[model samples]
Target: MEDEHKELYIKEKFNNIDYMMLKSITDCIYEAVCVIDEYGIVIVWNKSAEKLYNIAYEKIIGQNIEDFFDDAMVNNVRKTGVSIENKCHCPLKNHPVLANSMPLYIRNVFRGAVSTDRDFEELSRLYSELENANSKLIFLENQVKKNLGIFGNIIGKSSSIVKKIDMARQIAPTNSSVMITGESGTGKEVFAKGIHELSGRKGLFVPVNCSAIPSELFESEFFGYCSGAFTGANRKGKIGIFELANEGTVFLDEIGDMPLSMQAKLLRVLQEREIIRVGGEKSIKLNLRVISATNKSLQEMVKTNKFREDLYYRLNVVEINLPPLRDRKEDIPLFIDHFIKEFSEKNSKNIIKIHGEVMNILNQYKWPGNIRELMNVIEHIVVTNKNGIIQKNSIPEYILLHMKENEFFKEYPLDLTRAIRELEIENIKKALKITKNNKSKAAKLLNIPRGTLYHKIDEYKIKKL
Candidate 1:
């Protein structure tokens, strides 16, 4: 009799709760919640459910959920008296969701089932938004490329490069001889090409390597030989580099390597604005621009009598020097981006993002070979990258090892004594921070005496944060 009274009391208290209370509670949830009777008729539907399925409560309350959704989990749960959790389901033909359904039982008898569903379209919407953003970014980048004009191929925007570009543009229209001086792989040839493009010359740009030419053949090569004048010469008499470059630009690379004997002849040709073919008396008039590049200092070579002083002045009438990659760390990222895009398209890769840590490591490196080495490294990374993202591990092993070897003095100068001092000061500050500015604990952490730590702190001028 007491047990019966307890059951009656429990049933009475639950019966007091009504549909309005359940509606209020379920409507507050963000997910779609629906309840169905054991007969498969929809008994309750929250506002979220209505929005998710585009169905109203009045329309669905008495209707069978199976009529609307052939694969409704609630119907299965109601019939089987089992629960389904975290299953992907498609109720409407096109609408998909992740749903959970559980059987409801009272007094040891199955009554109904309830299911809650989270929308899958939300994630799809977010992915669409990201793709749109990427498209816009690519468009803006293309516009920036278009605005760069002929200088677009010459990538760096650092103050050193920008100033040089401006100077090149200003000197391009003039016919004065130009001498380009820089270390090898500093992009001297590309800069020369940019100048030639800006010069608006009608004739083709001719490139001659002074170091590659044989001393014996230099005269015949510069001044085309008459037919039958030299053995193995073209029968019709080949056009020389200068004659081929008439009304255009002549790029003389490694000009310091020109033999001293040929230097005087070249100076005479430049001075007289004419050249006589080998074994031919008639002089051919010339009209062209001279641009010479050399890794060696022509001044030093002139002082040593290796290079003619007159030829040096003729070539060095206007000089432009390119800075190496190590001096312009600010431009490394720009080069990395440009090279990655170039090599990715060439190799049919869709490389989209670079890992932040990879950028940091690349920026910290000192490129001994300048832009050329950096471009090669980026090509290797992109070609070997299996995923769309460029990770730190994708970097070449040599660069990673070099970075690790130099990790200790990354922020300090290469001077050993000064680097040691800077490292010591940095550690002292870290110890202080860890100890909450307590000198005793800080010294103990650093394995030094408290008095010594205090003296070192004062000496290094470290203060509490």
Candidate 2:
């Protein structure tokens, strides 16, 4: 019964119309499909097969498949009557493919074999890219090793940054009161420390957050309180920030948040260059460089009668405004490399390079939180990324959402033909919309043959309006 059924099936398959239908169906398949008779004669060849072997069926059909392809799987199955399933092989030079070949039998005799081949060119290209990326990563790692120690903490080369650094260096040796102003997380504190380091001061560089201190404790915090000044005062009479920073520098962070009452006392202390201990008669002389930082506009505060005019002028003697990260975008790459190295080491990761796509996203982001926010984001990425290279999927969700929709697809594609096809599909859709679904007009607009346009419309599965 099975032999009779097989004979009937073979008779039906050999019909010319049925053979043509089978060939057409094979052409539509994504994978390359081919058929050869038991005598090694090429019987059928689809478009993908022609592309894969670089041979058109018009010339290959009726010819021996063995002449074009050495050790061909289709010929092997036909000769041996054995199946090859999901076997990886290189049918063409340097073109790796996964193939499946099955022998065709009719009435208990081997007639032919059919094979499907999926080219691994894209996969091979991906591996090649990864190798190139690794080479680049090694170069960057060497660069980070050589240059990381030379640039110091401030890692920008922008004109604004260079000017600020130059100005800071020039004013460092002077006893001028400097105010560093910018948006929060703009590294105001870091700039202050940089100034203090350059001043050649011998004593400690003390940083005091004025906004964090209580109003009642302001006087005691700025100038040491006597042993019995307050109930919580130490019997030994502890020293204040000014006294601790004597002969060095005192960085008053968020100085704009200081209360008006404390502002008067601060102004007096700066003017006199001395501080009298609370509940003590003796005055303590101080030699210090006072550097204050704030994210607020003290001039506006002075106009509003909120910040003291005298105190503002005293602090603003040499004001250095730090530009926001967005204003100095050219410096972002430097910051990214610096932070990536710092955090990668801190997290015990050996990250070498960031993905180009990731860099694009980072560069384009507004960085509302500035350098500090960027630092945190890099740390987050480093901690989560297990490999030496950072991939796009490792980026935070919020950042990806913030980017323009079109920027995501800007990466160079591995398949040039596929990319061109996608572009064609987009333009075809646009042209169709413009022409209100008039195929003739759209074809003319695209400067393509009308028949070719119709074929592509069906090939790309484009829906008509």
Candidate 3:
């Protein structure tokens, strides 16, 4: 009776424990749980494991594990006696899974194995996204490096300009003041921009037109002012151009026109490497490279006491003088070809050739306005020459008139007034031909703002060629 009562008590406790509660707990887990017998047959499969494999637990249990996998996977796991985690595709189920298999051992006896699997498609997609992001990041880094280099947009092959660029490249690696002197339109700012791009500074290029700034605002503009420093001061203090250009380049354009008083302040900043605000007492340290440009003769200014001699000497440490366009007339064709292609593509025009005589006329003209003027002329011709070839008559009347008035042309026995009238008549005829008798197209092709071209055609009594 006592033995039976002990057995009954144990049975009563087990009967009170809920089977549904245990099943529910196992189903809620994220990882698959399973057990196998000694023959590699599935013995127990939980609800989580069933949902993961898309197979019912009742059907999988008591089935051989090899029924779901190839014999090779089973043999490998059995031979290693270690857990094997690998990716496998199930064609019948049309899904992919990452399976982990571990052998079960009992008292030094080899039993079967138990395995669990998880979805691999989501993980693979995530990895691909990560790889794409990394590629884009690398591309962006390369672009940033290129943009901060000296050769960003200074495209040319002329030996003189190339040599100047090479020298600028060499000096750009240092923090020195550079003075660029040249004729009015000779691209001094281009050299300054190249220096700024080459310098590994973290700040932007701050250009100040010394001549354009008002005399009254010179102090507060160069050196920042505190709030209420003057009558029109902002509520918050404003940073000066020099302060904003810290750790970069401050381009002083037309520096020859700087006021005498401002020149003293600038010289102090250069010597001391510090600035005191217009109305503040405290001094601030600066780390910037000054690149100044001017078309005026600084030495002449110094002699006349209009500019500070000390400041002139300080800024003249490394000077680059650009050659005038007339000096490098050999580069005219090169610039012409470049501009022609650039504008043709922009306007979707198919101008591919220039008549020999037209090119000769262009080469003979003295480019007083330099590259800027040359570029404008090329843009005009490309937009107006609709015959797909630039003819001599397509040249502007102003240029032709200038050439006629030239003293050199007089020595050649050319009739100045008659030649000007003839060239004007020829240009009008060519414009009409290109327009196919359409007055509007002809006017556009002449580049005289339509109304001007029409008025000229009427005044010249031009007929279709």
lDDT (0-100) at residue 71 of candidate 1?
84
Q: Count the backbone clashes (under 3 Å) in each candidate.
A: 0, 0, 0
Full-model lDDT for every candidate: 0.82, 0.81, 0.75
- Model 1 Cα lDDT, one tens digit per residue, 358-409: 8988888888888879988998998998889999889899988888665622
Position 23, candidate 3: lDDT = 52
User: Superposing all C-alpha atoms, what RMSD in Å does each candidate have to the true structure?
Assistant: 33.0, 40.0, 21.3
lDDT of 2 at 183: 96
Of models 1 and 3, which has the larger lDDT? 1
**Descending-lDDT candidate ranking:** 1, 2, 3
Clashing pairs in 3: none
**Candidate ranking (TM-score, best to worst):** 2, 1, 3
Deviation in Å, model 1, residue 414 alpha carbon: 25
> Could you tell me how far off, in angstroms, the CA of residue 424 lies in candidate 1 after the best superposition?
5.1
Q: Candidate 1's error at 375, in angstroms? A: 1.5
After superposing candidate 2 on the true structure, give the runs of residues whose Cα lies further than 4 Å from its correct spot.
1-151, 404-465
Candidate 3 lDDT by residue in tens digits, 1-465: 244553354244335556346556667767666655555555556787777667796566556666875542443465568777774735235666666777877666776565666667665556535643453455447646654322236655678878888989999988888999999877787789888888888866777789998888888888877657888886455678787777778999999999998898889999999998766777889999999999999999999999999999899889999887777777788888888888798778899789887887888888888877887898899888877999978888888889876622332227888777777676677667767778788767776677887777778877556
Worst 10 residues of 3 by lDDT: 6-15
